[model samples]
Target chain A: MSLIAVVDYGMGNLRSVDKALEHVARDGQEVRITSSADEILAADRVVFPGQGAARDCMRELESRKLIEPVMQAAKEKPFLGICMGLQVLLAHSEENDGVDCMGLYPGNVRFFGKVLNQDDPAEPLKIPHMGWNNVNQTIDHPLWQGITDGSRFYFVHSYYVDPEERSIIAGETTYGIGFTSAIACDNVFAVQFHPEKSATDGLKLLENFTHWDGK
Target chain B: MSLAKRIIPCLDVDNGRVVKGVQFVDIRDAGDPVEVARRYDEEGADEITFLDITASSDNRDTIVHVVEHVAEEVFIPLTVGGGIRKIEDVRTMLNAGADKVAINTAAVFNPEFVKEATDRVGSQCIVVAIDAKQVSAEGEPLRWEIFTHGGRKPTGLDAVEWARKMVDYGAGEILLTSMDRDGTKIGFDIPLTHAIAEAVSVPVIASGGVGNLEHLAEGIIDGMADAVLAASIFHFGEFTVHEAKQHMAKRGIEVRL
Candidate 1:
């Protein structure tokens, strides 16, 4: 039996994330939502999920002492980051001035403040970019299994990640401009959208993560 | 490809049972909230909204249980509305797995509550639901006023300006519903919706008076709304969420289908 730990550092609702993970977990696979460093490090697979400001997220992670365990999980275990979980993986973010993050990947989060859409050209896109958008897979990975290349996932955020390393970029999606939506590096797979709320394709992605061995 | 317009199915629940009424008159029971939510999820509904019509303090617990049951199976974003007064209410709904909470009358009574709720629980989960009634007609300056308590009491606040105020207070989204055309189902108040959608930088969800599929398209195309929400259209079996998405897709609107 393997235990999947979903890190809960006092951010937005992790209950739905935990419920979704448990819904797709197979026999002998258990999902637990914990902020404990030891429990996270002991888990076979780890999921880091969060939402809210980057600075606030960093503060909570530091106060809860989850920074080291999360970084360690990224390096060793099968780690999945969603929404702000993916943003905090970057080195710094421009949200609310500038906030330094976990530096799990060399990247920066940017705000899409009224950027003009390439498709529409005339009108400026909305700020929080909240809704369902298509994610075009850039590179092949186990997590992308069974999901179509241009499948749409539920996205709700004002900021998008700009990874410094080009090779780590796994998926790209267009909001105003083509922005990095998902990233993958060895054991770590992170996405800017909420797969827990993305309906069918989302459930499929979670099911794949549950069975994924991080190969 | 552009971002797909959302088709949301709003379930009006009264004391834990899913019910849809016309103009708050002749209310009829639809089905169990969980069962109906699950059907919509399977039918490719982008999101589901549970608006507690009862809004009674005692029934608040019932709404929480309803949200818990729906969130357990329906894996899409679930927005719970009605009677969300304070931060504790936000925490209660979020803990029960509701992705967002819609704040109405409280926002009109105490605007700072929106700011505080958004401050404590991020702007993404706080949705300010506005019930608007057009105070003017054609051949004149367009004006709409905010109405509270199911559009029975007028707050004398301008609809467009009120929307901007809520957004400035850190509301992530606006669920704008028109009381004038709510049960009429002729269509959305396009002018009112357009004005609010253009005024705010945040996404506006055009709601109420969605009679047919064409009305849904009008919300996104004409009204410039990011999403369209309706109750009777889906609750009464007039159209399924899948059919609505298909119709919207045929109209060249980007949809997940």
Candidate 2:
């Protein structure tokens, strides 16, 4: 029996994430949304899900005194970071002028320019890159067990991460340019797309996360 | 691979029950919005939009229950539109597990509502729904005027300029629906959709007037819409979301199959 602590920082839809996890969680594997440092530290796995601006996410985590517990949990067990959860792992973000992040991984978050696909002026590339896009598996990881090499995941964001060490990059997706979509190293596995909302392929990643021992 | 064009099935809910005028197909319980949402999610629908057409404001809270049940089961992104006039309304929908809230008449009545929403909530959750009707006569300069109150009232606003203004006002996305072709089942207003999509930097969801799968793909191909939304086609079981994706893919448009 293991506990999965979903860090609740009052950003985005924490309910859906919790429900999706509970849907796939095996029997006796408890899943709870908690800001309690003790529960987070005691959990077998941690899922940090973020939404909204990077500045606001940091502020909420700092205000709730969750930063320490989240960092500790990431270092301790199998951790999954999603969307802003993945962005905040980097050193800094270009959004909201600039915002400092957890620095769990060395990377800088940069914005997608106003126009994407400059070659095709006919299609005015929508910002926030809001749609289903393919994520090419760059490394052989446990999470890619059933998901195809270029499976599409739901993504909605203006900024993408750039890890200081490229080896940490696990998945790459092409929007305007190929950016790091998923990153993994040791016990940590983070994704810029919301696997909870990514349908069948997404559920497969979560299922893999449940079975991964963080090798 | 590039970003795949999205296909969204919209549900019109009136007083908590999915309106039965269009989606009268074999959905076990056709009135149940959650059942319908789950069906679409299983069939490979990229997203689901709930257009709350609740006539009375008192019964507006019913839509929240519907969203709560659907979001509880369905994992895909959920968008809630209709009767979003106040910030509290936006919060209620988001709290109900909606990934996005489309502000239609409220944003048209007061453009400041869009900015206030973006400031209060993130722009990502705020989608501006524009219902515009072609006002230009055939053979004349192409132009459309914004229509409010379900295409009954004219706001005297230029549809394309208003879309740009909303984007600048911090709207993350625009849901453009053609009032003229809404129920005709012929197709979407291609030029109108093409105009607004070209005008805005945010993703535009082309809605209304989708009789068949070809109409859905046309929005992405010629109109350049980031996503295509329809109700009657899928609800009536004429075609599935899989069929729509296959049709778009064969047409050379990238779609998740």
lDDT of 1 by residue, A14-110 (tens): 9888989998999999999999999999999999999899999999999999999899999998999999999999999999899999997887898
| Stretches of candidate 2 exceeding 4 Å from the true structure | A114-119, B22-26
Model 1 segments more than 4 A misplaced: A114-122, B21-30
Residue-wise C-alpha lDDT for candidate 2, range A35-146, written one tens digit per residue: 8999999999999999989999999999999999999988979999999999999999999999999999887999888336474776656789888999999999998898
- Give the CAPRI class of candidate 1: high
After aligning candidate 2 to the native by TM-score, how far in Å is the CA of B137 from where it should be? 3.2
Residue-level lDDT tens digits of model 1 in B95-114: 99998899999999999999
> What is every candidate's C-alpha DockQ against the true complex, given to 2 decimals?
0.87, 0.84
* Top of the candidates by lDDT: 2
